[model samples]
Target: MRIQDAGVIFGILGIVVMMVIPLPTWLLDFLLIINFSVALTILLIAMNTKEPLQFAIFPALLLITTLFRLGLNVSSTRLILGQGEAGEVIHTFGSFVVGGNAVVGFIVFLILVIIQFIVITRGAERVAEVAARFTLDAMPGKQMSIDADLNAGLITEKEARERRRKIEREADFYGAMDGASKFVKGDAIASIIIVVINIIGGFIVGMTMNNQGMGVTQVLQQYTLLSIGDGLVSQIPALLISTATGLVVTRAASDSNLSQDVLRQMLSYPKMLYVVAGMLLLLGVFTPIGILRTAPLAGLLAVGGFRIQQTKAEEAIKQQVQAEQEEQEEVRSPESVVTLTHVDPIEFEFGYALIPLADTNQGGDLLDRVIMIRRQLALELGIVIPVIRIRDNIQLRPNEYVIKLKGVEVARSELFLDHFMAMSPGIDDPRVVGIETKEPAFGLPALWISEDMRDTAEMAGYTVVDPPSVVATHLTEILKRHAYELLGRQETKQLVESIRNQYPALVEEVVPNLFSIGDIQKVLSNLLREKVSIRDLVTILETMADTAAYTKDPDMLTEYVRAALARQITHQFRPPGQPMTVITLAPNVEQTVVDNIQHSEQGSYLVLDPAISQKIYQSLNEQIQSLATAGHSPLVLTSPNIRMHFRRLLERILPDLPVLSYNELDPSVEVKSGGTVTI
Candidate 1:
């Protein structure tokens, strides 16, 4: 049996031994005092500590026991040394063992104490069991983090709430049912039987002691136990101790919420057996000294049981740490990806990259093979792309190739025609005749016009290289380099100037001419489209700056100028759909919006999409400036993407804005489908 189980059995035996053996009066006094001290210590600390202080229990009990033992020795020495008369001792002993103080009151109190202990233990056990089961259902994983829940709009919010409620209700129902059944069938009946038997036995044993006169069983005479009228007055201290032992045992057994049943069992393994044995031996040693009058062994049993109970608390903390580790590992496995919300801004940049594809075999001539390759590339990358093939004298731009294979008759005919055309009247230059025939003269360009010219190559795909050391790699390298350069710089001045001078005609022509969208948008579009910039963000703080000046109903003059500049630089290069992180700010910070912009983690030092972040920064700066100009204290607006307003911008210096006041909001920003409204 477990150590705690052994303690319980030993406690029962100790109670029996007290009534049957009728321990010495001095010994009974020692038992009473020690029991009362142990009980009071338990109660005081239990009521005081917010969390159970397992370490305090042992020392507190020991100190109280030592103090009481010393007090008992001093008081008992006076009584044993003939300090009182024989008649007085006889009257006191009879009153203490058989009088009202010991019989009715003690019996009533023990019953109540046992019942209270049972209720407390059973309730705590139920709570732990329910909590363990609840944690199992909510284990953290990829499914819990990234997948759209009703809150995210991937699932309906109503559905998510309903599911959560259903789980809570089901758990509550099962827990309540189990608790009710266990209490009714188990502890309730056992408590009634034990209390009744103990009270009856104590009464019968006390009567036997009354007949024996001032013997050891006559508790009041030989000891300092209070005598009120006819019996020994056992104070609140002894009752409190017995009740405390029961309470501690119940709490120790019942309060585990660990999901691992095996661990709980290990923690609860009773160490109380050793303590019980030690207490039993101590009870015998003290009994010979006439210390315990009626229940020397009972005090030892209660103290031992309480000690074991205190030691079990460490198990709860250890189990909690174990559970967290297990759950963390389960959440991080390969199949699961942890999608973290950006509490603060985070940015990553990638430069140019080319991916090669697997080769395929087809039974086709060179020209057919080339056409097939072009079709395959288009299918893989999801775009219709231009391909250039170059070999001999004829140069191929995109979608064109040249070959220089000699031909006999056609070449001779072309030479004869060229000579005749040189002598002809209208074709004096000989070039006009060649042009009329859709051919070039000798020493000028000419083509044999083969029906089997190579259009596409099948087996392999090629990548671009910078500097074009090998002719084919040049095109890709140039485009990749342009993208990388765009990340760092704001605009290309030459492209901006050209687009500004040309307007619509240039905008239309420039887009197709550029290698990538970032190239066109970063340089040209900045000059023509909405020119959102850091400088524009700074302008919003001006005195009397209009609230709508940043976006929606911007004053248009400054906004338009920035847009025009952006159009010149980056109109063709900008990417679609801006992504934002949640940012919160301290309420008291001045210039909340503009100050936080420089530190935002939304982009790398260089960005693939600067226009998006630039626009957000500008709008925030303008709002803060507008607030300052209006004479309002700066207040931060928190959202997935934040807007800060510092009313009364004119009153304060612009350089004093506090940027570090920004913070990443919890859970990040919530984004939903069909959420964007185009302006």
Candidate 2:
């Protein structure tokens, strides 16, 4: 062990040994001085700490100090009864300090005990208990605040974690202080009992066993003086520690230490000092107390208050001048305009009436829901979603909200806070009457119904959802639709670094060696654009490593990656034991797309005749409408070679439609033909 650690261990052992072994008077005197010095040091530290957690070890220290004092008492009591003297320190406290009078010394000791045990210790104990209870009760609210700050980007993840740790430490410190305060109270009671035992026992021993021809009166005076001195010596340190405990438990967290906070806060208003000064002067003049005694103090107070007022006025003027100078500098600086060019990746802005949806105090949980949305998207999309910036905008209507992606509005909707949206189940019921509307997410027929009609809507086979749920659902779909735009080269590098921790060789071989971060980002974005999960990055990287040698085209590489993730895509569209329903493209359409492909220096493109493109779009629309009539999603199945080209043709008309090649389907899954698209 290190020297410092060993010394602490040995010191504790020595304190325990002091209770058992009889010590010399000189050694006892030295220990008594050390005990007093340690107590004074503790009181000073308690006053200097700005917050209680700064002295987190105080509870344990209190236990150790109490034990040390008790050991000293045991040793001193033994010496007093056996040797007729404890130490020079105790004798001086008895004779010189108290004027050789036993009754006066006893009264002094009693006063110290009353101040510590009844006043300081009792109040500190109650404060500690209440503080601990309140700290524990406020934990949930504090945790939510940290999460809100994190979601708002006000603090980093590491800072939020550190804040949470501090809150827990505060709770623990107060709880321990609540129990440790009892030690000081118990020590006070033990001191009184020990003093009585020492006096009574000293009398019996001095007169009978070791009297040396002393009488009862002389024996009583000698022993009583020593006993009271011992009580005083012990109680002095105990009283200092009790005061320290009161200071620690009652101190609220602030930026400054005890003295600085007291001066700054108590003297914040200089006018209060003037009122006290006037009161002092009035009392001296009206009563017969004589003006000479109070006039000097009153004059000093008035001067101090006047100077403080003048200083505050000067500070206010200085601040105003500084602010004006800063404004002029900002107007002339080029960086001020440059800062406005930056845009958030994702933003959700609502009108004034929608404030309660994001405010925790008003029962709003939108911030918490945003956090969950990010986590859910991360798990499902295999990419960390950027922090969504949410704020209020006055230009929008009270019920309107807009979702923006990279400074462009992608989706907007309106919500009725007091009503629930209930979508009909195709069999409309006249009993479920309400305001007609459409579901913002899917544009399905819906009605805005009241809280009382929620059960009625459900009973009538309508899907009922609250306003927050509607907003959350709509936001989730918008993010999924634009998940590709959120993933950039930086985000791709983060994913690569995460993979490198586990599969270092695989990442080193694929990234920067065969493909750059931008190349990998493009492939990932292409997958996300089609609503495919990129969570299986390992498999995607392996596929890129295999095909990167022959092709530098990201689209081709993405196609190869999809074929490798056939099982994932198949499971996504076709559930377990369910046949996949899809519309098949005719041979003519597939051949025409393959035939129109032209290669360039940049990349390949499908240059189809405008008439052929129109005919193809019309054919695909017919199939989609037929699928919708049958209550099925529109999924197009095409040849492996023409799948990318066909998807590009339908990108503008049916961006959300799922297009898959035969190679991207698992062999075990059965495919059912829903219809055919022909031109």
Candidate 3:
């Protein structure tokens, strides 16, 4: 072990040894001084610390110091009774420090004991107990706050963990201090008992066993002084330690140390100082106390206040100048432009009237709903959604809100805060009539009804929802639609790292080795674009690992992955025990698409004539319209070879349409052809 660590062990052992074994006067004097130095050091450290946890080891240190003091008392008592003197230190304290009067010395020692045991130690013990109880009680609330901040993306995972750890440490520190304060109280009582024992024992030894033939008065005077001296020596250090304990338990957490906090807070207002100075000067003038006595202090206070006022004024000017300089520098700096260029992945901006929807104090729960939206999307889409930055924009109308994707406005809507949106169920109810509007999310014809009409609307077969729900639903749909755009290279890397932790070998085989992160990101983006859930990422990666050697194209790989996830895709489109209704490509259309397929290094595209493309589009629209009329979603079922090319062809016109291959359907799924797209 290093010398410092070994020294602590040896020192604790030495304290134990001092209690039992007799020591020379010089060594006892040295130990007594060391005890005083240690107590003073602890007090200084307690004063310097801004928070109790900064002195976390103080409880154990208090115990050790108390023990050391007790051992010294024992050694001193032994010497005074056995040899009529402890050391020069004790003798000097008895004679010179107390003016050779035993009674006066005893009174001084008792006063110290009262101040420590009754005042400082007692108050500190109570404070520690209350602090411990409150800290433990507040732990759950503090933990929940941390969790909420984490969910809201106000803090990162590391910060949340650190905050939790600090709370636990505070609890433990206060609990330990509650038990440690008792040691100081007990040590005070022990000091009084030890002193009494030494005096009584000293008197008996001096009068009965002395060969010098000392009288009662002389023996009492001699031994009483030594005993009181010993008491005073021990009590001084104990008092310092007790004061240290009180400071520690009472100290609140702050950014600065104790002295700085005290000075800065106490002197924050110069006007208070000036008023106090006036009061002191008036006391000196009116009171019987002489002007000479208080005049100097009053003048000092007045001058100090003036100086502080002047200093503050100077500081304000300096700060203003510094701020201006910093602003100028920031404008000139290239980094300012760089920061302006950055954009959030998703942003939800609302107007002033919608503030109550995001504010928790006003009973709004938009933030909570946003958290749920992120979690819901993660489960449904298999990607962690980025934090949605929410703020109020004065540029918009009071009731308007907009959702932005990568700095571009994607969707916006208006909401009447006090009304409920009611959408009709096919047939309009004249009784459920209100301000007409369209649903922000689905653009369905809806009515903004009053609070009184909510129950009537529902009873009239119209679906009703609150303003917050409308905003939340609208936001969820927008995010879901643009989730693929949010999954950039960085987000893709995070997803890869997440899976790497669990399936390292599988990730190692595919990522960067066979397919780079960019290649995998493209494949994932393609799936997400088609409203596919990549939640089963391991299967996707495994599929890629198997077929990566044959083709590096992301489109072809996505096709293989789609086929691999046939069951998921089938389950996604076709509900359980339900027949899937889809439009199938005609033989002629399929052959034409295959014939027009052109391949190059940049990947394949269908190079069809404009006339033929128009005919194909018209035919596809007819089939899709028929399916919609039949109350079925438009899904094009084509052969595996042409599915990817066919999707690219009609994506601009029918972006939401699902193009599934024959290989992408599960065998057990029942498929009924809705219509055939023929040209």
Where's the lowest-lDDT run of ten residues in candidate 3?
146-155
Candidate 3 overall lDDT versus native: 0.91
Best by TM-score: 3
* Least accurate 10 contiguous residues by lDDT in model 1: 349-358
Clashing pairs in 3: none
| Each prediction's TM-score versus the true structure | 0.21, 0.63, 0.73
lDDT for 1 (candidate 2):
64
TM-score of candidate 3 relative to the true fold:
0.73
Candidates 1 and 2 compared: the better one by TM-score is: 2
Off by over 4 Å in 1: 1-23, 52-107, 114-121, 128-679
Q: How many backbone clashes does candidate 2 have?
A: 0
* Candidate lDDT values, in order: 0.34, 0.91, 0.91
Tens digits of lDDT, candidate 3, 247-350: 99999989988899988888888788778877877888899986888778877877888888899999999999999999999999988899888898899999
Cα lDDT of model 2 by residue, 1-679, tens digit: 6999999899999999999999999999999999999999999999999999999999999999999999999999999999889899999888888999988988888888889889998999999999999999999999988876665457888999999999999989999999999999899999999999999999999978864788888888889999988888899999999999999999998898999998998879999999999999998999999799889999999999999999999999999999999998998899889878999999999999999999999999999999998899988889899889999999999999999999999999888999999999999989888888889888898999999989999999999999999999999999998999999987887777666657989998997899999999999999999989999999999999999889989999999999999999988888457688899988888888888999999988899999988898888888889988987777889998988888888888888899999999999899989889888
RMSD of 3: 6.4
Q: Higher-TM-score candidate among 2 and 3?
A: 3
